[model samples]
Target: MSMDAVTLPDLSGRTAIVTGANSGLGVETTRMLAGMGARVVMAVRDVDKGREAADAVRGETEVRWLDLADLASVRAFAKEWKGDLHLLINNAGVMAIPESRTKDGFETQFGTNHLGHFALTNLLLEHVTGRVVTVSSSLHRRAPGIEFDNVDLVGRYTPYRAYNQSKLANLLFTLELQRRLADAGSPVLAVAAHPGYAATNLQSHSGSRVQRALLAVGNRVFAQNATAGALPTIYAATQDVPGAAYAGPKNMGGQRGAPALAGRSEAAWNSVAAHRLWALSEELTGVTFPLTSSTG
Candidate 1:
C-alpha cells in the first residue's frame, strides 16, 4: 500500500495531541491529522519549534509544551488539558543517548518513552473520547523483556540495550493498558506503531559516534522519509484497529514500506510480563489506571 492508501475518516470536530510534534514523524502525523480536519495540539518540549512546524501545517493546530522526560512537565501538560481528546499519540522519545536520568531520577529512555506517557495517559484518560496510539520500534525485538528488577539498567546499561528495553516497554504498556481498558469496559482503544527505519533526527543523538555515523548513512541509503514513516501511526490512530494491534511497514523486513498490521516478538505478547511491568510502572510513576468502569 502507498502512503495514500489508508483512507482516513473525516476528523472534523475531533481533537488530537501529538507529543514531539515539532519534527519528523510527529510533525508528519500532526500534519496528516490536522489536514484531515482534526484540531491537533502539537505537544512539544520546544514551543518555538512547535510553532514553526505548526505554521506550515494547513489545518487547525496549537503548540503546547510537554517534556516527556520530566514527570512534572507531563503533569503540567495533562492538568491544563480541557475538553475531549479524540487521539493521544505518545510520540515523543529519546534514542540511544548517553546513559542519563530524567528529572524525576529514572532511566532516561524508559522515563521519557514509557513512564512519562504512562502518567500522562492516566492523567488525561477521563477526557479521552477515542484511543491512545503509542510509537514503539522494530528494535524492540532485541529486548528479552523489561528489566523489572533494575529497570534503569544501572550497571548493565548500554545505549542500545536501554533503547531496546524502552521500546519493548512501549509494546507491553499498550498490551496492559488495552487489557485494563477492556476489563473496565471502556470504548477507548490502546494500540502501537513503529516507523520502521525512517530517516529522522532521532538517530543523531546516539551516544556512540560510530553508531551515529552508521545510522546517518543508513538513513540516507535504507530508510524511508518521515511522511512514509508516519503512515502506520496515522492508520493506528484513525482506523478501527483492534486493541493492542501493532502497525509497521509491510516490506523489507519491516525496514521500509507502506504501513500494515505488523507482528511483535513473543516477549511483547507475554501478559504476565505486561501486567508485572504495569505494576512496576505505576509504582515508579505513581499513576494508576483511572477508570474502574466506563463512565459512559
Candidate 2:
C-alpha cells in the first residue's frame, strides 16, 4: 500500500500495544497510532531503546519491557498491564537467523514468531476488546504446511525454510483464533497483515554476507521504506475489516502498494491445519484461550 494511503480512524480514547516498537515498522506504527490519539505502548526488549523511539514520536506513548521469546516476560507484561486493551499488534519477529532456541527451548524462529505471540494473545485475551493484528509475511505463501513434529528443526534446518514455517504459522494462528473468538460470541477480531518487502532491521541478524549485499541493493531499488511497509498493518487495525482478513500491498504482486485485502496461499486456507496448529500451540505454550468449555 502507498505509505500515505490509509487515513486512520480517530483512536482518541483507545489504547494499543505495539511489540518491537523500537525499530522499523514498529516505530512507524507506534508513531501513526499515537498521532491518531491512542495511548501507544511501545513494547520492546530494551526499555531504554523503546523510550528513545517513543520520544521521537509526537503523542501519548509509554515504554515497557517485553521479551516475547521468554514466556515469563510475556505473562509478566500482561499481569502488570491495566485497563482494557483496544489493540494488540504482534509485529515483532525474527527472520532467517542461524539455528537457535528461545528461552523456552523451542526453535528460535517458530518460538519467537509464532509461539511467543500465541502465548501472549491467550494470556491477555481478557484484556483485548477490539482487535489483534498479527504481522505475517508474503514468504508464507511459499511454505509447505507446518511440520508439527519437527517444529524446532532439531536435526534438519535451513534458515529460509524455518523462517517460512514461522510466517505460515502466524496466518494459521490468526485463522483459528478468529474462529474460536467468533464461536465464543466475542467481539474481539483477529487479523493478519504483511509488509511485503520493507527495508527494516529484521535483516540485520543474519550472517550471510552475500544475502546481505543483495538485500542492501534490493532494499534501495525494489523495496519500500518502513513507513510504507507499515500501511497494511495500519489498515488492518483501523479499517472495518472482517475477521481473519489478510491485508497487504496491492501492487507488484503484493511487494509494495496501497493497503488492500491480499490473497493467501492454499495451505493458509486449510482449516484442518489451522485447528491442528492451534492445539499444538496450546500444548507447547500451556496457555489457553477463553473459549466455551466444550470448545476447549
Candidate 3:
C-alpha cells in the first residue's frame, strides 16, 4: 500500500511501550499511536525530555524512565510494568560511537541496541500479547554476522561495524521471537522495521567527525523527516500481518519511499542462528524466556 493510503486500526484499549520516545521517530510513532486511542508509555532515559514530547501529543500518555545502557533500569521498568501490553516497540538505540561499554561491560552499540532490548523483551514476554516491533536498520547487511567468540568486539571495535552487528542482532531477535512464539502457540507477533534515512539525532553520536558532518548535510538533502521515517515502525506494530514480517520503505536501494514489506538477509532466516542467539542472549542477560523446545 501507499504511504498515505495506510491507516492505523483502532486501539482504544491497547497499552504500548515505546523506547526512545523522547524525540525523533520514536516520538512521532508514540504520538500517532496515542492519537489513534492507544495509551502509550514513553520509555526514555530523560523524564523531562519525555514529558515535553508526551505533552505535545494529543492523547493520554505516560512517561517512564528507562536507560537501555543500564540493565538495572531495564529490570526496574519491566518489574514495574502492570496489565496486558499490546505492543512493545524496541525503538531506542545508539548509532556509531567511540568504543565504550554499558554498565554491565558489554560493547556499547551491541549492549544498548541489542542486549538491552533482548532483556526487556524477555522481561515483558508474559505481559505482551499483540505485537513486538524491533527498529533495526539497512546497515544490518553490513556486518558478516554475529561474532560468537568476541560478541563484545573488545579487540576489534569499529563504530560502524559494531552498529551493523547490533542491527543484525535485532533481526535475529525478531525471527527467533516469532519462532518461539509460534512454538508456544502464542498470539504475539514479532516484526522488524527500518526508518530508511530519516533525519534524527541518532547520528549525533557518530565517532567520525567526517561522517557526522555528512549525515548532517544528508539529513537536509536526502533524508526524510521523522514522521515519514516512523511509518514503517507504526505499520509493523499495528498491521494485521503474520509473525516475523519486516517492514520498510519501498525505495531505491531501500532508501526512501512508501512503507511496505522489505526483504531480510538470508542469514536472518537461519533457524540455527536464531536459536543460538537466543541461548546466548539468555546466558548473557541472566534472563531466560519461558520458551519450550516446541512452543506449539
Report lDDT per candidate. Answer: 0.92, 0.92, 0.91
Stretches off by above 4 angstroms in model 3 are 1-3, 291-296
List residue ranges in candidate 1 displaced over 4 A.
294-296
Tens-digit per-residue lDDT, 1-296, candidate 1:
22456567889999999999999999999999988899999999999999999999999999999999899998899889889999999999999999999999999999999999999999999999899999999999999998889999999999989999999999999999999999889899999999998999999998688899999999999999999899999889877689999999999999788888999999999999999999999999888889996544
In candidate 3, the residue pairs with backbone N, CA or C atoms under 3 Å apart (3 or more residues apart, or in different chains) clash, namely 183-295, 183-296, 184-295
Instruction: For model 3, state the Cα shift of residue 25 in Å.
Output: 1.0
* Model 2 global lDDT (CA atoms, 0 to 1): 0.92
Q: Tell me how far candidate 3 lies from the true structure as C-alpha RMSD in angstroms.
A: 1.6
How many clashes does each candidate structure show, in the order listed? 0, 5, 3
Error of 2 at 294 (Å): 9.5
> Model 2, residue 73: displacement in angstroms?
0.8
Query: What would the TM-scores of all predictions be?
Result: 0.97, 0.97, 0.97
Sort all candidates by lDDT, best to worst: 1, 2, 3
Give per-residue CA lDDT, model 2, range 127-155, as digits (tens): 89999999999999889899988888878
Error (Å) of candidate 1 at residue 62 is 0.5
